[model samples]
Structure formats: structure tokens, C-alpha cells
Target: MRAWRFHEPGNIANLVLEEVDTPPLNIGEALVRLECAALNPADRYLVQGQYPRAGAPPFTPGRDGAGTVVEVGPDSRFTPGDKVCLLGGGLTGVSLPGTLAEYAPLPEAWLAPIPDAWTFEQAATTLTSLTAWRALEICGGLQSNDTVLVTGASGGVGVAAVFLAKALGARIVALSRSAEKRKNLIALGADAAIDTESSTLEKEVRAAAGDQPISLVIENLGGPYLEKSVRMVAPEGRIMVIGLLADLTATVTIGLLIHKNIRIQGMSVNNFKAKEAQDAWTKIVDLYNANHHRPPISQVFPFAQVQEAFAHLQAGPMGKVLVRCSA
Candidate 1:
């Protein structure tokens, strides 16, 4: 099998494609012939050796993908030819021989059935959607009519968060740096879209909510925005921090936090407990199948053009970028 493996992570250039022996499926695992593999900012971190997952040289680096089962272990529930999406098995390009290759062995527990209506490209991006759904619905304690703010509202998770928040009947205020992206967010059901570049984000958000403090904040950036989010949240409002795209360190006012009684929570979709992940997957599948929401793909790249896909993502895109692993 031809796999893109990280020799010694320093840059994207380190990812080299080579023929490698395919591993046999273990008990409770199934081998999937990948059709698509989705990349995230985490992939960039992994390639740069910034991610905490320790490993020696020569490891494949994708985390989420969609494929068909070509081989299943006797103990697994899925049979060959079953369409599935994989989550949380550390089989990503960084940890194991990930979906970047033509074949991947995933634990049965991590596999979920993809809806017939969903293309392999869509299913490959399910992990990001699931993460956003989990953060807003489960961890954020989102309620109908709740006023929410989604920072980084143009990225993969942000787009999913917008759709999920809308489906839940929440009033959403999406913040983005680009006007064009803001327009897309509005179409995705954001009640209001703010250009963070020109306006005061806190004021804009507050105004959009009609002076009501934000009930929940789906935060992706974590610098000045974090401090501002702390101040903008209503009393007892939940602020779920899902990403730190901006500077990680920031000076915040403790007085504002104490006075407002805000709950600042940090969430990593990958860190969810098994039960939590199962629940999230169930909800995501339900939504996907019901046609309640769908993630927008900004672009799709062929497996050979994986580097271009990564570059486009790093340059900032309006939606998820998918790598088609199969024809």
C-alpha cells in the first residue's frame, strides 16, 4: 500500500509517500479501504511534531476518514463492504498507518455507519461536525432560544456549530474575519454575522443578542477573544473552548469572571470519554440521516495532491477541505 508517513516531523515536507506493508486486523477491528480522509489543524500540529502523541519516525498521520469495510475480524459486527466512518482509534496519520493510505485497520467500536445520502466526502468530515455538535449540545448545555456566539465561524467545526445551533433553535451570532465568509454563515442559519476585523466583537455580539449576554460561546480562538468572551458571557453562561487558533496565552480579568459567574470550559473532541463519544456519534448520525444539517466542503483534493489541500487549509478557507482517497 502507498502511504504518506511522517519520517521526522518538522514541516509538511516531511510527509513522504512510500509503499508500506499493510497490517493485519486485530480482534475487534476491521480493515477499511479508505475512500476519503479529512484533514484538520491537528494534522498540521502532528506534522510539525507539536502534538503530544509521542511516536518514533515513520508513522501515518490522518485522524478521521470514511471508507468501506474490505475485511472484518471475526469478533467485529461489521462485515466486508459495509460503509463506515472511523473515530478515536489513534489510527490517524500521526499515530498508526492512518486513512491516508488505501487501507486502514480500525477498531469496531470506533466505526459508525454512514448515511446513504451522505457522500464519502461528507462522511470523511464527520469527525469535525461531531466535535462541534458535542461541544455545543453536550458540554455547552445549549438550549432552544439560547443566544450563542461562534468564533472562527468559517472553519470546519465553526460551520458545523452554526448549523447545529440553528437546528436547535438557538439565536446564533457568527464572527469571522472575512465579509464573504460572514455571508455564508448567515446562509447557514446564523441570526447575525459580525466582521471581527472592523467592529468591536463584544459590542457587536451584545447588540446582536439585543443587549442580552451570550448564553453560550463556541470559542475556537483563544487570545484577546478569550478575554472578551469571558466578559461578554451572561451569568452562569457556558463558554466552550474547542480550539486555540490564536495565541494560547492571554491575560484575563478575574474580576469579570467572578462578577459574571461564567463557566469557561475547554473541550477537545478527541478527549471525550467513550460513552460521551458514543452519544455524540449517535446524535451526529441522526442529524446527518435526517438531513437536519450538512457540513460545507470548501474543496476536495485527490490523494496525490494532499499537500495542496493542507496548504489551502492553512491559508484559511470558508469550510472543510477533504482529500478524496478513492475514485
Candidate 2:
């Protein structure tokens, strides 16, 4: 099998494509012939040896992908030719063989059947949608008619958050620096879109909020933006931290939390229980089938252009980037 193997990751250039032995199918696991794999910002961090699991190299690198089962191990629930999508490989390409290759062995628990109406590219992008759903529902506790603020609203999780928030009958104020992307967010059901580049982000958000304060904030950018989000939340409003695009460490005024009684929760798909993940998947698939949500694909690169795909994601794509693992 040919895979994008990390030798000693310092950059994407260090990820060399070479023939590697296929992983042996173990009990409770199934072998999937990948059709498409989506790249996340986490992949970039893994390449830079910034991710915790990005220790020793010589492993394949990818986390989320969609494929068909080619072989199922003993006790596995999947059957050959079953279409499936998976979310975690615990830092794949870092600690384990990942979806960047033509095939991967995934634990049955992590595999979810893909809908017939969805394409492989769409299935590959489901992890972000699931993350968004989990963030809004489980972490943020968003309710109908709730006004939610979504930062980094142009990215995969952000866009999905907008769509899911709309589907739940929640009002959304999406934030993005690009004016064009802000327009796109509005088209995707954002009640209002604020340009993050504006010096008066708080003013714009407050203006959009009118009287009712933000009931929930889906924060993607951490660091200083988190402080702003903390300030924007209504009294006792929850803020869900999904990603730290700016800085890992953040500083916020302690007085704000004490005064407003804000609730801050970190949202990670890895931390979700099986039932929670299943619930999220069900909602995402139903939304897709209802034409209420669609995974935005910014670009699709061939398997050979895996490096380019990583580079594109690192440059901050407006939507999801995918690698075509097979024809």
C-alpha cells in the first residue's frame, strides 16, 4: 500500500509517499479502502511536531476519511462493501496508520455508515459537521430562538455550526474577516455576519444582538478572541471552545467571569461518548438529507497532491479540503 508517511515531520515536505505494509485486520476492526480523506488544521500541527502524539515518526497521517469496507475482521460489525466514515485515529499519521493511504484499518466503534445520497467527499467532511453539532448541543447547550455567536464562520466546523444552528431554529451571528465569506455565511443561514477585521467587532456583534444578549458563543479562535467572546456572552451564557486557531494560551479578564457568571466548556470529538457521537451523526445525516446542511468543499486534490492539500489547509481554506484517495 502507498501512504503519505511522516519520516520526521518538520513540514509537509517531510511526508514522503512510499510503499508500506498494510495493517493487519484485528478483531473489532475493519479494513477500509479509502475514497476520500479530509484535511484538518490538526494535521498541520501534527506535521510540525506540535501535536502531543506527534512523537516518533514513520507513521501515516490523517484522522477523518470515508471509504468502503474491503474486509472485516472477526467480531466486526461492518461487512465487505459497506460504506463508512470514521473520525479518530488518535493522531493518525502520528501514532497509527491513517486514512492518507489507499486503505486503513479502523476500529468498528469509530465507523459510521454513510448515507446513500451523500458523496464520498461529503462523507469525508462529516467529522467537522459532527463536531459542530456536538459543540452546539452538548457543550454550548443551544436552545431554539437562542442567539449564538460563531467565530471562524467560514471554516468547516464554523460553516457547519451555522447550518446546524439554523436547523435548530437558533439565530446566528457569524464572524469572518473576508467580506465575501461573510456574504456566503449569510447565504448559509446566518442571521447576521460580522467582519472580524472590523475594529468594532464588539459594536457590530452588539448591534446585531440588539437587546437580547448572546445566549451561546461557539468560539474557534482562542487567545485574545476568547477574551472578546467571554465579554460578549450574556449573563450565565455558555461559551464552547472548539479550536484555538490564533494562540493556544489565552488571557481573559477574571472580573468578567466573576461578574457575568459565564460558563466555558471545551468541545472535542475525541471526548464525546459513543452515544453522543451517534446522536450527532444522526442529526447531521438527517440535516443533509433534508437539504438543510451541506459540507462545503473548498478544493479536492489527488492522492499524489497530499502535500498541496496540507499546504492549502495551512493557508486557511474557507471550507474543507479533501484528498481523493481513490478514483
Candidate 3:
């Protein structure tokens, strides 16, 4: 099999594609022939040494993908030819060899069966959608009556949150620097879209809140965006910090933190237990099955252009960027 590997992390420039032996299918794991793999910011970060190297090199970086199961370990629930969505096995790309290769062995727990008749590209969205779902539903305890705010609203998780929040009947206030993306967010069912580039972040957020306060904030940009979220969220509001597209460190107001009874929780899909992941995936599947919420794909690059794919993601894509893995 052919795979991408980086000997010592520096940047995407270090990534090299070459022939490697296929990973062995171990107990409780299944061998999947990948059709598509999703590129994420974390994958880019790993290449640049900004993300953790779970183990030694040569590191294989990837997490989300869609594929067909060709073999299963003893007593596996999935059978041969099962159309499956790869949730990237938590941090498989960092911890072990991952889905960027044509063939991957994924744990049974991380592989979810694709919804009937869904495209591989759609199935490739499972990881990002589930991250958004867990952040909103589980950590934030979102309610239909709540007015939600999504930061970095054009991002992969942000887009999913918009669609999911809309499906669950929440009024959304989306924030983006791009006017065009703001328009797209409005069309995707956000009640309001604010500009992140504005100097008056607090004022813009408050105005977007209007009469109904922002009950929940899905904070994707950690530093300045999170600080703004803390100041603007309604009293007793919940903030789920799931992404660090901006710098990881944020100096939040302790006064507001104490006075408002605000609950801020940091969430990562990589830390999910098997049951948490399974339950969240089930909910995602059910939500998409309802035929209202669909994950958006902005681009699909052939496997040969893997470097270009990461470059495009770093340049900032409006939605999911995919790599076609089948050769």
C-alpha cells in the first residue's frame, strides 16, 4: 500500500508518499479499503509540529475517512463489504498508522456503518459532525429555546453546528470574517451572522443577540474569540471550547466568569470513550437520516495531490476538504 509519512515534523513539505506494508488487522479491528479521507486542521498542525506526535515517526497523519470493510477480526459486528465511515479512531494518525493510506485497519468501535445510500464523501463527514454534535448536545446541553452562537462559523465543525442547530430548532448567531461566508451561514439557517474582523466584538455579538440572549457559544477560535464569548454570553450561558483555530491560550475575564455563572467546558473528540463516541455517532446518523441536515463538502482532491489538499485547507476552505483515497 502507498501512504504519506513524515520522518521529523516540520511542515507539509516533510510529507512523503511511498510504498509501505499494509497494517495488520488485529483483534477487534477491521481492514478497510478506503474510498475517501477527510483532511482537518489537526492533520495540518501535526505536519507542522503544532499538534502532538503521539508516538515515534514515521508519522501517518489522518483521521476521518470513508471506506469498505474487507476483513474483520474474530466476532466483529461488521462484515465484509460493509460500507463504513471512519471516525479516524480518535487519534489514529498520530498514535498509529491512519486512514490516508488506501488500506487501514480501524477498531470496530470507531467504524460506523454508513447510512443507506449515502455517498462516501458524505460519510467522510462523520468525524467533524460528531465533534460538533458532542460539543453542542452533550457538553452544552443545548435547548431549542436557546439562541446559539457559533464562532468560526465557516469551518467544518462550525458548518455542521449550523445545520444541526437549525435542525434542532435553535436560533443561531454565526460569526465569520468573510461576508460571503456569512451569507452562506444565513442561508444554512443561522438567524444572524456577525463579522469576526470587527474591532467591536462585544458590541457586534450583543447586537446579534438582540432580545434573546446567546444561551450557548460554540467557540472554535480559542484566544480572542473565546474572550469575546465570555463577555457576551447571557448569564448562566454555556460555552463549549472545541477548536483552537486561533492560538490556544486565552485570557478570559475572571469577573465575568464568577458573576454570570457561566459554564465553559473544553471538548475534544480524541478523548471520547467508546460509548460516548458510539452514542454521538448514532445521534449524527439519525439527524442526517431525517433528510434535513447534510454535511457540506467544499473540495475533493485526488490522492496524488495530497500536498495540494493540505495547502488548500491551510489557505482556509469554507467547508470539508476531501482526499479521494481509491486508486
TM-scores, all models, native as reference? 0.94, 0.94, 0.95
Looking at model 3, residue 4 earns an lDDT score of 83
Q: Each candidate: what lDDT?
A: 0.81, 0.84, 0.85
In terms of lDDT, model 2 sits at 0.84
Estimate the TM-score for candidate 1: 0.94
- Model 2, residue 135: displacement in angstroms? 1.1
- Across 9-111, the per-residue lDDT of candidate 1 in tens digits comes to 7988888878889878778788999998888888878888888764567878788899999998676788898999876434345565677888888777777
Q: After superposition, how far is residue 278 of candidate 2 from its true place, in Å?
A: 2.3
Candidate 3 per-residue lDDT, tens place, 1-327, comes to: 998888887878898888899989888899999999999888877877887646467877788889999999889999999999877537677686777889988888888888786899988977778888888887889899999999988988899998888888899999888889999999988889988888887787788778999999999899877888998899999999988888879899899999999999998877777777878877777887795566888799999899999888777678798999998
Give stretches of model 3 more than 4 Å off: none
Worst 10 residues of 1 by lDDT: 88-97
Q: Which stretches of candidate 2 lie over 4 Å from their true place?
A: 88-94
Kindly report which residue stretches of model 1 are placed more than 4 angstroms away from their true locations once superposed: 88-94
The 10-residue segment with the lowest total lDDT in model 2? 87-96
Best model per lDDT: 3
